[model samples]
Target: MASLLYRLGRLSFRRRRYFALLWVVLLGACAFAAVNAPEAEDEGFTVPGTESQRAFDLLDERFPGGNSEGADARIVFAAPDGRKVTAGDTRAAVERVVDEVGAGSQVREALSPFEDDAVSEDGSTAYSTVTYDAPGEKLTEDTKKALMDAVEDGRDAGMTVEVGGSAVDAGPEFGGVTELIGIGVAALVLFLTFRALVAAGLPLVTALVGLGAGICAIMALGLPTTTITLALMLGLAVGIDYALFIVSRYRAERAEGHPAEEAVGRAVGTAGSAVVFAGATVVIALAGLSVAGVPMLTEMGLAAAGTVVIGVLVALTLLPALLGFFPQAVLPRAHRAARQPTAAAKEAAGANETTGAKETTGAKETTGAKEAAGSRWARFVIRRPLASLLLSVVGLGVVAVPALDLQLSLPGDEAQPTSTTQRRAYDALADGFGPGFNGPLTVAIDAKKADDPKAAVAQATKTLKATDGVVDVSPPLFNKAGDTAMVSAVPSTGPSATATKNLVKTLRAEADRVEADAGASMLVTSQTAMNIDVSNKVTAALVPYLAVVVGLAVLLLMIVFRSVLVPLKAALGFLLSVAAAFGVIVAVFQWGWLADLLGVAQTGPVMSMMPIFLIGVVFGLAMDYEVFLVTRIREAYVHGERPAQAVVTGFRHSARVVVAAAVIMIAVFAGFIGMTDSMIKMMGLGLAAAVFFDAFIVRMTLVPAVLALLGRTAWWLPRWLGKVLPDVDVEGEKLTRRLGADPGPPARTTPREESVNA
Candidate 1:
């Protein structure tokens, strides 16, 4: 790996201009393709074999007129004074909206609620159903613009107008503001860490180039999945992080007195190798999402995994090329001045130098200046490993406590901020009708087997109405063929409410009972039921999915570290960090702790898909710090030092770079909270917390303690296993050996003659 990286660095440096032009042309092409690519569709989460899916299939089969496979929306109208929508003026306004919206070429039909007594009892609100020819998510940009414009026109007529439903809410928006904020924060962190403008800007430039290309690639592929937002988010964060890691290591190597080209090679050979492994771990974790067997998730995982791969490749190749052009300028002015001696200082140093006295004094000063703080931290933790371990555990436990009560559900409009028109429409419908009116359950009754179709319909209605949670059951609407009919049943609770989910299960169970006696088959489905199915599937798959990812991570770590205990410790720390992050999500988004301060409008269950995505993403991300820190410690251990001393020395070398990388990652992820989408916000906060805790608490404190406590056993491996496991030299130890450089503690003191000659 070291030799390969060295060659790569030399090639990149020699062919820097060619590489630069190549990347520019490639990114330009990607941008062009992305501009021409079709907009992504929101393929709602689906488990094909589930009961809700079965019902949906039956409906689409038995009744073709309803456009059951397409999108449905509701245009809600309300008066300012809570006056009845049935009043003359209000009714006229509603009629005009229906007419304008229904006349659009995109709409298949618009059904007025006034004709069907769908208005509220107080007459304060009414809504019309607008069915589009295509699935709402697949609607063209022009069609959406037309629909929104029509809906907006209603406000001019003195009516409160808002549109709700999956279709209306699925329109895509940008996180440009959030992305800019994240970039700014990341820039600040890089500048402070490097204290060099050129050094700080390099990582950001590389990251942006990779991100821009990756996003365009995703768009160009036009994968029949909803992964644009996820791809962009992952691409941006990982791109920045990968570049930061490599660049920081490169700068450190330069400070160690290696020439520009040699520094780049050593940095790429060591830290760049670590970046590849870290990026692969993340990609593997995301790709593991395909095991859940959901098409949407599978595609999303692939899309994100591909973007991460791009980020890694760019960091490895293009960054090296870019760095070669301005190696001298990469270091800060102060750093450069420090490396070169002034004439007066050189003369004074020569006069003071005698025997080896000056050499020994300089070594001590170097150690004191460079190793004081990190060494102190390492020694402090090592001296009281038990106490350190206990404190770290206690801190993580406090943050994880809220996870015990974590509730998972799809984020409905009720959880959305009130600033959105979708939320306003959702609120109006719930107020005028009932909470369940927004997500009514559709019961598809197959009556061909029953002795009497009418008898089956009547029996099913009676059974549903008798169910404890049923709020209202609509009369049966039979298909023209008379072989099937559908019934709409609203639950007593809101769509995302726990009670509503339970109601779905209860009704499905009762339908089985009804079918047994009445010789009929009933399949219940709706947006709410489908959401419950997705949640249930994810819940069932969580433990197994985690087991797969953790096992893979452990195997990879063991190969790299060649230690049983090290991998186990890393995996455990990862779990603790993820749990703490989830706890934060539960407390803020679920328990409403300081939610208002964050601009969250309503507190509810965490998004159903959050845990699955978070576990995969955060676990992979946490490993990044582990790889950086542990590799350095292992490098020291291999070079000859007591286990305890090695831990301190290695940590002192790597802590700064690891922490800076984590801060950059956290900033990029947390920036997503500024997005309009609630799901994105939850994801941002969860990921930021994961990186924060993993870097500060786990890697900084707990890992050192555990390594200290284990002593020599921390590096132990069976002879057979050692021979079987390939050596993953992530720290360029071989290169140091080949170059005949002192890989151990910095030479205690220079030879007397060498010191005097200086």
Candidate 2:
């Protein structure tokens, strides 16, 4: 693999123009395709094979022109203090607003509060329901304007009015501010790491180019905006990091006296191999989302995987080609001067053996000093392996304690900020009508098989009303054919409350008894029920998903490191980091710990898909850090360095770049927290926290400690297993041997030196 990559890198560097032009053409074509692609439609949250979904399908079948795919608005009206909404002018104002709303474009109908009995018991507040002919995202600006105008009129009439529901929902706000901030921070980190503008800018340039192409292709495929946003986030992050790794390697090779082309080849052969392996882990984890059987999550995973693949390709091909164009500029100033010595100066310096030897000694001393400083943290962990391991494990375990109380639910209007009209309306309805009034379950009764449909419908309604958690059951409304009856049941608890989830389960359980007695089929469903079903489905899939991801991690790392314990250690470390991340998410988002500091407007259950999604993403990234750091250690050990010395050498070569990459990843993920959408915010914060735990705590601290304790056993594999496992030369061992490069000095460590230096 290294030999093949080495040849490819040299070919790309020699024919840099052709590769550069090819990428440009592809980017342009993708952009054109994106511009011509049809608008992407949202598939909304739909979980098949669930009772709630079945009920929805039944509704679509029985009522062709119903509001199943359409939008709805609830205009909540609150009277002034000492006033009743049903009194005189207040009543007249409510009726006027409902009439105006009904007259708006795309509005199918708007029921008056008085006619629907939507007035509060005290008559202090009321609400009207407006149904639209299209989905919320498809509603015209004119229609939204008309609704707002009517709301303004009601307010002018001495009433406080707010519109909530799907019709009034504006969807997620994404203005690119967060992405820009992330990119900016990444640029700063790169510049600081490289200390050369040209070198730092190269990674950013390559990343942006690859990201643009990936995003444009995703757009061209007509994926939803949310998917594109995710692709952009993952693509930019991995692209920059991959390029950074390769570029940093190329500079290190050049600093070691390799010429431009050879340095590029070695860098691509070595760092590029690690990049490919790391990228595969991410792709596997993300694409594995298909096993969850959720269409939206599947799309998200696949899209992100594709973007990461593109990032890898760009790093392997485009980045090396770019490096070939500015070899000297990419190196540090000191290295550049040493690399470009004039023939006369070289001849004069070489004429005196003692002078040349002194110059060489000085250079080695300077390099040694840098290595010592870089490996300082590794040395600390190595010296106190047991204590370091214990500290990391205990600290992470403490953080993970909060995850035990994690609760997940789909975010609803109640989860929105108080500043949003949806939240205001939700609060008003809960205050005036009831908490359950905000989310009423619709029971679909199929009575066509019953001898008497009306009697069957009546029996089902009675059964629902008798349910413990049901607050009220509405009169059954039949379809035009009179074969299907729909009953609305309001629960006593809020939409996301635990009791509401229980209510859904109880209703489904009671359906069997109702069917036996009335010979009718009942499907309990609603937005609330669907949310419950989705959360349940995600939770059920978590273990299976974790199993698949962990298995993949073990298998992949075994191949990369060629060791059983190393792979096992990597997988366990990944789990620890993920647990810690989940703990932080639960504490902040669910328990409301430091919620105000993080700008959380309200706290409830964590988003249903957060845990599984976090596991998949963080697992991939954790493997990335693990592979990059450990592959170097394995490389040093393979080259005949003692296990202790190899640990120091690996950290000396890879720690700075790994830390920079991790910081870049954290910056990108953290940017998402700035988004106003609660789900996106949660995703951002979770990923950021996960990267922090994995990179700094697990990969940096725990990994070295564990490796030090294992010593030579860290790289061991059974002879039988070694023969069975395919040899993937991720460290460029074959390339180094083929080029006849010196494999560095041999290790001669005493027991005391091993204990102290390791």
Candidate 3:
């Protein structure tokens, strides 16, 4: 693998223009395709095989346009204190608003509060319902604006009015601010890590180019908007980090006296191998989302995986080609200055051996000082391996304690920001009508098997009204065929409440008894019930998903590291970090711990898909840090360094790059917290927290401690297993040996280093 990569890298560097032009043409073609592609569709949250899904399908079949699938809005109006909305002026104002809303484009009908008996008992508050001809995603901007404009009449008449529902919801307000912030932070981190403007800029450039191409391809495919957003986030992050690794390795090789082309080749051969493997791990974890059987999640995972693949390709091919264009500028100032004498001597001596020896010696001394400084933290951790391991484990365990109380539910209007009209409308409706008013469950009764359909429908309605947590059950209304009946049942709690979930379960359980007694089938479904079903489905898939992802991690890591314990340790550490992240999310989003500080509108349950999604994403990134760091250690070990010395040697060489990459990922994920959508915000926070825990705590601290304690056993693999496992050569061992560039003897340790390592 390394030999092939080495040859490919040299070819790219030598033919820089051809490779550069090829990438440009590919990107341009993708952009052109994107422009001509169909618009992206909104994500659908249907959970097939669930009762709610069956009910929805039944509605679409029997009721057709009468179902709740079409876009609809509830415009809530509140009069001033001591004033009644039924009064002449208030009633006139409400009627005027209803009329204006009815006049909007694509509006099927708008019912007045009085006509629907939607006025509160006190008559101080009322709400009108407006049904649109199309679903929310199909609603034109003009129609939405018209709906908003219609409410101005009621507001002008001294009545507080807010519109809530899918018709008025313009999916999360993403103005590109978050992406800009992420890119800015990533660029800054790269500059700090490289300390060379040209080198820092190169990664950003390649990342943006690759990301653009990937996004264009996704757009051309017309995926969901959410999928594109997720892909962008993952793509930008991995792209920059992959390029950073290759670029940093190129500089390291140059510092060791390799010429420009050879340095590029070695860098691509070594670091590029790690990049490919790391990328594969990520792709495996993400693509594994398919096993969950959720269409939206599957699309998100596959799209993001494609983006990562593009990032890997760019790093291996485009980046090395770009590096060829600026050989000296890509190196740090100190390295460039150090190399000037060597360049001059090469010119003066015409490849003389004496000058080359002096150049190599000077470079070695500079590299030695840097390694000693970088290895300090590694030494500190391994010095008291047991203590370090215990501290890290205990801290993460404490954080993970909160996960025990984690609750999962889909976010609704209540989870929206307080400033949003939907939230205000939701609060007003709850105050006037009931908390359940916003989440009424629709009962679909199939009475074709019954002796008398009307009697069966009536019996089913009575059964629902008798159910616990049932606040109100509407009169059953039969369809044209009279074989299907629809009834609305309002629960006594909010949509995300535990009681609501229990109610859904209870009603589904009661359906069998109803079928037996009345010979009619009942399915309780609504937007809220569908949300609960999706949540339960995703939650049920969590354990199996974790099993698959963890198993994959073990198998892949075993192949890369050629060790059983190392792979097991990596998988366990990943679970620990994910649990810690879930704990933090529950504390902040569920328990309301520091909720206001993080701009949480209301605390209730964590997003249903958060845990599984976080596990998949964080697992991939954890493997990235693990592979990049541990592979270097394994390299040193294979090169004949003692286990303890190899730990120090690898840490000194790879710690800085790993840390920088982790920080860049953290920054990108954290930027999503600023988004208006609660789901997106939760996703951002969970991913960011997971990365922090995994990178700084698990990989940086726990890994080294465990490795030190295990000593030579850290790299152990049974001979039988070794023969079975194909060698991945992630450390470029074959290439190094073939090149005959002897690593030389381990540097003699200083007294301070010896004491730390003792």
TM-score on alpha carbons, each prediction: 0.91, 0.93, 0.93
Global lDDT scores for all candidate models? 0.79, 0.84, 0.85
Residue 619 shift from truth in candidate 3, angstroms: 0.3
Question: What's the C-alpha lDDT at position 53 in model 2?
Answer: 91
lDDT (tens digit, per residue) of candidate 2 on 297-408? 8888999999999999999999988876776677665544552544443333222110111111112212333234447678888999999999999999999999999888
User: How close is each model in CA RMSD to the real structure?
Assistant: 5.5, 6.9, 6.6
Please say which candidate is ahead in lDDT: 1 or 2. Answer: 2
Candidate 3: where is the Cα deviation over 4 Å? 172-179, 338-373, 741-758
Clashing pairs in 2: none
- Tell me the lDDT of model 3 at 54: 93
Candidate 3 — worst ten consecutive residues by lDDT sum? 353-362
Model 3 per-residue lDDT tens digits across residues 103-217: 8899999999999989999998899999988889899999998988888877989999999988978664443577578778888988877778898999999998999999899
- Model 2 residue 748 distance off true place after TM-score fit, in angstroms: 39
Tell me the tens digit of each residue's lDDT in model 1 across 1-758.
76677668656765778988989999999999988988655455567878988988788788886635577788898877857778887788888888888887768888888996778878888888888878876777776777788787888878888998756765554476876888799899888776778878888888889878877888888775357677777887788778877776676665555556666777788878888888878888899987776677878788888888988888888888888777756664544455443444433222221000111111221344333355668888999999999999999999999999988888778877898888999998998888888889999999988999889888988999999988889899998888788999988789988898888888888888888988889888987888888888888889889889889988888887889999999999988999999999999998989788766788888888888888988887888788878887887788776788877766666676677778888888888887767888888889999999999999999999999999999999999998998886776777777666543223221233134224
**TM-score: which is higher, 1 or 2?**
2
